[model samples]
Target chain A: MKKNKSDLIRYLFFLSAILSIALIILISFFLFKEGTVIFKEVGFLNFILGKDWSPTNTPSSFGILPMILGSLYITLIAILIGGPVGIITAVFLVYYTKDKHYRFLKSIINLMAGIPSIIYGFFGMVVLVPAVRYLFPSNGNSILTAGILLSIMILPTVINLSEVAIRAVPRFYYEGALALGSSKERSIFKVVLPAAKSGVISSLILGIGRAVGETMAVVMVAGNQPRMPKGIFKGARTLTTNIVMEMSYASGVHRNALIGTAVVLFMIILIINLVFTIFKERNVNG
Target chain B: MSKIKIKDFNLFYDNFQGLKNINMNIEENKITAFIGPSGCGKSSLLKSINRMNDLVDSCVTNGNIYFDDKDIMKTDVTQLRKEIGMVFQNPNPFPMSIYNNIAYGPRTHGIKSKEELDKIVESSLRKAALYDEVKDSIHKSALKLSGGQQQRLCIARALAIEPEVLLLDEPTSALDPISTLKIEELLQSLKDDYTIVIVTHNMQQALRISDNTGFFLNGELIEFNETDKLFTFPENEKTENYITGRFG
Candidate 1:
């Protein structure tokens, strides 16, 4: 009787494990099924590289080049701003900060991760927008503003993962450097940081993912202009922002185009995750 | 002449005493061995010479350690460490190429010319007796080397800086018999140019390579004498018991 019960429990657990994979497959199937319709209506190249994104006119154009450029630009700028700050902060936490202060600061960083994205959006709209307007030449809602806000939003992920990576390095490497008469800073930068290279890189890549997928906070700051990104100070719309802004009232080909936008975004995420996995595997093997 | 002198040195980790009122004089260009059971503070005393004990948050030290008649506590720590290099119990070559690992110390001390670094790298590896084996694979990652080769790479890394004294903590304890013999022979050759201090659990190893031996028990130095005399005729009962394989 006990053996039968144990077998039933094992089968149930196996079912639960398979259920998540099944859901992922279902979601991907649904997305592709709906998303491919736009490619049929508009050639894939024309839809992707058309440059013009007019969906409401008599003969609408459905080029996502502008939104793609905007997303790429925003993600690049955000990583540029956030990557160094996050890595340096992580290094400080692991090597420099004392125990008591480290605990307190770590908790604060964890709390930052938990705050809602809506709250971040509200904060960006009220605080960062006005600050950018006051300090810079452009209006409150611009690519620069969105980039700044997105960088802030991605900080928690960058800091936390980089910290874990840096700390994961064996203590002996640091001791070895010290034994060689290297300074503490030299040891950390030259030995410890290099040892944690793949981890730090993955952190930046994950941060880029967070910045790319961010919608609510970005929309609040970015002007949502569906055009090619003009300059750092000019307004633009990312792929995510374009979909979120028009999904409510979009119809027919327009709705499909938006879903098509999601497909592109999904591809971008897939590439980022692929790069992360490659680096992780190399680190493990080497 | 004495290269290092420990005067009434006491060490504590928080409130727990690790080394108690230790005093010793280490001679220049001689291999001095510290033998003790586990947790008896032999490694602690070795670490104190290079001020590695400073890394421990709760570690406290009383009394002065003089290197070349100058108090080490008052000297700049980085400078002190440069003068006194250490090898850990575990071989920990940096996760970098063997060539780069040797270059790290010289680079830290501001040697930037590639040709000069190359020369130093070759000479250091030669001194550690690892050059002939790893010469063709200089750019290969140190982690790829065997355990004994990695330990030798670490020795080459320490030798790159041209330190006056080398302190090793159970360096061969992790190696097989042949690897252990290789290291013991390497230390024998190194002692002519560098003052050597080693912490070992093996009494036979101490007798074979060391000129002087200090036997420690329960955070105290129970005996210190020439290795030949100490092994043949121990003055302390505890040292005799330890050397006789009676009890730790």
Candidate 2:
């Protein structure tokens, strides 16, 4: 009787484990099924590479090159702003911070992760927009604003993961460096940091994923201009923002184009995760 | 010449006494080995020389540990460590290339020129008896090396800074017999230039490579004498029992 009950529990646990994988396969299958319809209507190359993205014109053209570029630029800028700050904060938390302060700081970081995306968007709209407008001459709703907002949004992910990675490094490396007469800071930066290199890289990749997939905050801060991003100061439209901005009222080919844009975003995230997996595998093997 | 002097030294982790009041003098350019059963303060005493015990949050020390004439507790810790290097029981080469691992100490001390660093790396590796084995694969990750090679690389890393004293904590306990013998031989060669202090569970290891052997029991130094005399004719009953393969 005990063996049978245990076997049943084991089977249930296996089913629960497989359910997530099955859901992912099903979701991807449906996404591809729906997303490919637009490619049939417009050539795949044209859909992906064309620059003009007018969905409501007399003869609507669906080119998402601008949106793709906007997403790339915004994500790159966000990583630039957030990556170093997050990593430094992580180092401070792991190595330098005293035990009493560590708990307080850790709670605040956890709170940052728990805050909602919509709240972050609202914060950008109310505070960041006015601040940027005052600092710079432009209308403030630009790629720079979006990048800054996204940078803030991605901080929790970057800092938390980097901290964990840094902590996961074996204590021996730090001891080894210290025993060789290296200062605490030197030991951490040179030896401990290198030992946790793959984990840090993985954290950055995850941060990039968070930045790319973010939609609500980017929409509120970015002016949603569907043109090539002129510069850091100019407004832009990301693939995510493009889909969310028109998904409510878009029809026919317009709707399919948005879904197609979703496919592109999905592909970008997939590639990022693939890179993360490769890095993780290399860390394990080498 | 005495390389280090411990005067009424006592160590505690929180309220638990780790090392009892101890007094000893270690000579320069000689290998001193501390042997005892597990958790008997052999390693604790070894770590005390270079102040590695400072890493433990609750660890407290009383009295003096003098390196040369300067008290180690008062001297700048980084400077003290540079003067007194250490090798752990487990080989802990940095997760970097073997060449970089050797250069880390010099780099920390502000040697930036590539030629100087290269010379230091070669000479340090040679001193650890690891240069010929790792010369061609200098750029390879130290983690890729065998257990013994990695331990030797760690020794090379410690030697790179030209420390006056080297503290080793059971450095060969994790190695096979051949690797253990190789390390013992390396330590033998190393003692001419460095004051070597080692902690080992192996009585044979202590007898073979050490000039002076200190037998510890329950956080106390039971015996300290020349290795030849101590192993062959122990003054203390506990030391004799331990060396005779009786209860530790």
Candidate 3:
């Protein structure tokens, strides 16, 4: 009787694994089916190259160049501002900070990670957007404001990933460097940082992805105009914001265009993940 | 006489005393081996010289440690560490090309030019006797090397900084007989330039490589003398007993 029960449990486990694979395959098929329409109707080149993005206008232009530019702009700013600070904070937590404070700070960072994305956006909206508008009214509802807000939204991800990466470095690596008479900072930058390069890079890529896809929070603060950003203090819209703003009340061509935007975002995320996987594999094999 | 001096140095880890009121002097440019049973605090005493114990958060120390006429505790730690290098019981090479592993220390101390780094790496590896075997593949990852070569690479890394003192905490404990012999031979050659202090559990190693030796028992320095004299005629009965396979 016991043997039969054990066999049943084993078969159930196998069934769950098969079901998980089936679900992923189904999702991929759906994405391909929706995205294939673009190749047939608009052609990939026109969809990618055409810059006009006024879908609700009389003629209904649907080029995504502006939104793509906005996405790139916001992602770039977030990475530029967040990358160094995140890495340094992680290094401090792992290598330099006193042990008594480690646990307390680590838990606070963990809490930041656990908080919902919407909450971060709300905080950014209520606090940062208004503050920027008050201080620099001429730059109100600008790309700079959105970028700064998104940097905060993604700070937890960068800091958490970087901390884990730095901590994951084998204790012996630090000891070995110290034993060689290298200063702590030198060891961190030269040895620990290089060894954790893949992890740090992945963290940066993750932050970029989050910034690119961020919708509701960015919408509330980024002055969503679906136009190319002129500078740090200009309004903009990303592929994600374009979809969220129009998807609820769209029909026919407009819906397809928004779905097309989603497909592009999906591809961007896919490429980032693929690059990370390749680098990590190379690091392991070497 | 005071090449490395410790006066009433007591070390503790989280309220547990690791070494109690330890006092000793290590001569200059000589090989001093510390031997004892497990947990006798030999390694603790060796680590105190360079303040490596500071890496441990709960490690608290009382009393003085002086090296070369300066109290090491009060010196700039980074400068002090640059002058005093260390090796461990287990070999740990940086996860990089073998050449980079040797070049890391000198490069950190402002040796920027590639040609200069390359020369230092080569000389350090040759000194550790690992250059010839790896000359063709210096750019290859160090993790691919054998255990003995990795240990030697670590030694070469320490040597690249040109430290005055080299502290080894059972450096050969993780190696086989042949590798251990190679390291002992390397130590003999190295003692000409650097003051070497080794902590080992092996009585044979102390007798073989060290000029002077100290024996510890329960955090206490039982005896300190020249290796030959200590082995042939120990001043303390405990030292004689510990050396001759008596109670540890």
Give the Å error, residue B19, model 3: 1.6
Compared with the real two-chain complex, what DockQ does model 3 have? 0.70
Lowest-scoring 10 consecutive residues by lDDT in candidate 3 chain B? B73-82
Instruction: For each candidate in the order shown, give its overall lDDT on alpha carbons.
Output: 0.93, 0.93, 0.85
DockQ of 2: 0.82
What TM-score, over all chains together, does every model reach? 0.98, 0.94, 0.94
lDDT (0-100) at residue B82 of candidate 1? 91
Pairwise TM-score winner, candidates 1 and 3? 1
Retained native contacts per candidate, as fractions? Answer: 0.83, 0.86, 0.67
The deviation in Å at residue B133 for candidate 2 is 2.3
What stretches of model 2 exceed 4 Å from their correct place?
A: A1-15, A98-101
Candidate 1 C-alpha lDDT tens digits along B30-89:
999999899999999999999999999999999999999999999999999999999999
For each candidate, report its DockQ versus the true two-chain complex. Answer: 0.87, 0.82, 0.70
Q: Write the per-residue lDDT of candidate 3 for residues B143-182, one digit (tens) a residue.
A: 9998888889888888989999999989999999999999
Candidate 3 segments exceeding 4 Å error: A98-100, A134-137
lDDT of 1 by residue, A1-286 (tens): 9999999999999999999999989988999899988989998889889899999987999999999999988898899999999999999999889999999999999998998888998998999899989998889888888888888888899999999999989999999998888999999999999999998999999999999999988888899899888998888999998999999999999999999989888888989999988877776775
